[model samples]
Target: MSADLWKPSAEIKTLQQRAAILRTIREFFCDRDVMEVETPSLSAASVTDVHLASFNTTFVGPGHAGGLPLYLQTSPEFAMKRLLAAGSGAIFQLCKAFRNEEAGKHHNPEFTMLEWYRPGFNEFTLMDEVDELMQLILAVQPAERLTYQQAFQQALGIDPLTASLESLQQLAIQQGFADIAEYETHRDTLLQLLFCMKVEPKIGQNKPCFVYHFPASQAALASICEHDQRVAGRFELYYQNMELANGFNELTNAKEQAKRFNEDNAHRKANNLKEVPMDTRLIAALEHGLGQCAGVALGIDRLVMLATRKETIKEVIAFDVGRA
Candidate 1:
């Protein structure tokens, strides 16, 4: 490697901006009486979300996890939920998170995440908080709240819920999208393709936007909407063609959660990916009776990119994996 590779990727002023942003974030939470917290970056039980990959390592020592594999924390959700189960109300954390297969203009193998929980809040309430935070940070206009169905309908001229697989596939082909045949059989994958290629780029072009009521299949850990039955209680915050946060109305049913984990592992098996270790502690927490709560995990680096008006995340972060 050249000597220049040792140089920090971010300029001094950008580093200043990052520091200031951190301070502002802490102040934001403090003002709301949300206690700041810290949790482990590694866990014996990793996440089982099929879409997320966790970096694993083996521990070797006496009186400890001898020869046992531990996974880097993908998010602080499980631990935070465990705290909520222990009666810790309204907590937030700004910490390092890891994923195995991620590297791009907006992704890093290791990244910063700002995760928080609000007890007694529903999905809509959390979405409103996210919008308000954007207003506080970016001074942006009031966010446009769009349902997943509405976004798909106006952006792609199809109703996502009622559209058949062939219709979605044909739309993809018509949009000059190539190699979508592999995704044709998967409904969620097709929806993702259309949303990413057609809808997402158009959202938050001029202001922050909140897209909610995701399809049940792609909800991950969110609960299914009681009224709609088909939509999950999930919302994503976006600005300037970038996704900044993912929020969910916490699902407290232990059995349903375990079922989802098993399904996720099965999907991973079908895809030939490693099946992640299930977080039994989190499941136990749910069994212990977690109260109604909604939480969100925001990408701090991406937020910094937006706050600093940087074109790419590399400009705001001190180092990308390539440079590190």
Candidate 2:
């Protein structure tokens, strides 16, 4: 019960800026012939990624029937892909997404997401589109592009794709990062630490930067690099060390997707978390055939924050769930 916790003037200005940015975004896509689309907020299954914790709830049907398990989507990715498979060309959506265990200056349990897909486009083509859209929305020049390896090399003097786990851990310690031993077994955990502690702070100093071609193991939902075989077709946009978007070439192989999903579930089980059911409908949609496409999900709040130079996520949001 803090009396000074609220600020009406600051919140109103932030909301105004946020609305202007959203309007600009819609106008940008409209001018580019990207149709705005909407999808379900609740699903029978949630994303299987072990790193993301989905918010689960129970829904009661007609006649006061027993509740059925449901989950608020972490992103509109699966449903949007289903639409892509069914021939929705060049679509975009701005919607609210939920995650269970995220709350910080940059994170909230409920936040806005701007997701888009480009049919018949590869990673590079869609990345250019993202750049143009960002410029249009922010009324600023386009950002720079840096490969994942290049960013790591510039920050830590090591090739992330080739560095051993011990090397990464040692570097973390040398950089005065505490809890280095805590991430020795998880390669991604160590990479995340280094990226956040050393690399990210140096990115997008002048303009946004697209960090592309991630290691295959950290692909998440992106396709693997055919040329290198050890890297994936993934990229994340950063502005002033803040993550703004994640994009990738769509992985259309249903079988490979299933394998990856299973691997994710195995990791979940090992971590003593509930194994999320795979989206069979998505798999079916993939089996029916989806064209070569690339998609991206950007944090709308963070974009607004960057545009307005806001420090905390709550400043950009109107009535954050915690306050609600």
Candidate 3:
């Protein structure tokens, strides 16, 4: 081991600034009357989202002669929604979330997340609140809003929602992306690849941009738009080409939620990934009436990185995954 193995990844000064930013965030939520809460970092089930990989461990205690498996939460979303169902109005949490096999300039295996829920709020209203918070923290001006279709049109001259699969494949080939022929049957995968590679780097260059009305197929937990059946009420906030947060006009239909979970598992199986146990309690909570609400999850370390003008995640965190 190196002699500096015991040292923290970030400087003491940067850590101090990080503390102040966290305090400011808490104060901001408190002033808005949003109650701060905590939830477990470990759970019996993990999120079925194929994009996220979770860390798991064995628990050999309590009611079992054999070991029981537990997974570290990728986000505090499920438990928080359960609290919302139990009449916890307008709550927020600053907690650690873990994801396996993730480490890069902007990622770590474990990171702080700021997630919140607002009762009786839609996706647009939630975007306004997120904009206000970003202005307060990063000292940015008012954000620019665009629909997902508009973003794609502006950046790539293609309408993602209406484009044919063959057209998208042609675009991908023209863009010189390798190995895209394998994903011809996956329309969403093609759209996502083009968006991440081309559109994401172009938007939010001047100010925060809120991209809303995602495709119905990509809506994980958001309700489909009543006027536009092709899209859902999901939005993402991006700043300086970095994705800052994702929010949704919460979906409260239990049957629909269960169906989505199973679909996710099926997608996982098709992709040769492990099938995750779905959160039955969350489904039960939805069945018990969660009512109208909007929720968002933001990455705190990334926010701090933007605020502090740091290039890497390690500069803002005291101990990143490698150091830990």
Quick one: best TM-score, which candidate? 3
Candidates 1 and 3 compared: the better one by lDDT is 3
Q: What is the alpha-carbon lDDT for the whole of candidate 2? A: 0.88
The TM-score values for the models, in the order shown, are 0.97, 0.94, 0.98
| lDDT against the true structure, each candidate | 0.90, 0.88, 0.93
lDDT of 2 by residue, 36-125 (tens): 999999998889998899988888988548888889999999999999999988999999999988998899899999999999899999
lDDT of model number 3: 0.93
Worst 10 residues of 1 by lDDT: 177-186
In model 1, the runs with Cα more than 4 Å from the true position are: 64-66
Decreasing lDDT order of the candidates: 3, 1, 2
- Which pairs, if any, clash in model 3? none
lDDT of candidate model 1 versus the reference: 0.90
The digit string of per-residue lDDT tens for model 1 on 1-324 reads: 787988788888998989998998899999999999999997899988877888988888886645877889999999999999999999999999999889888888989999999999999999888888888888899899999999988888899988888887888888877587446587788888889878999888899889999998889799999999889999998888899999999898999999999999998898888888789999999999999999999999999899888887778888888798
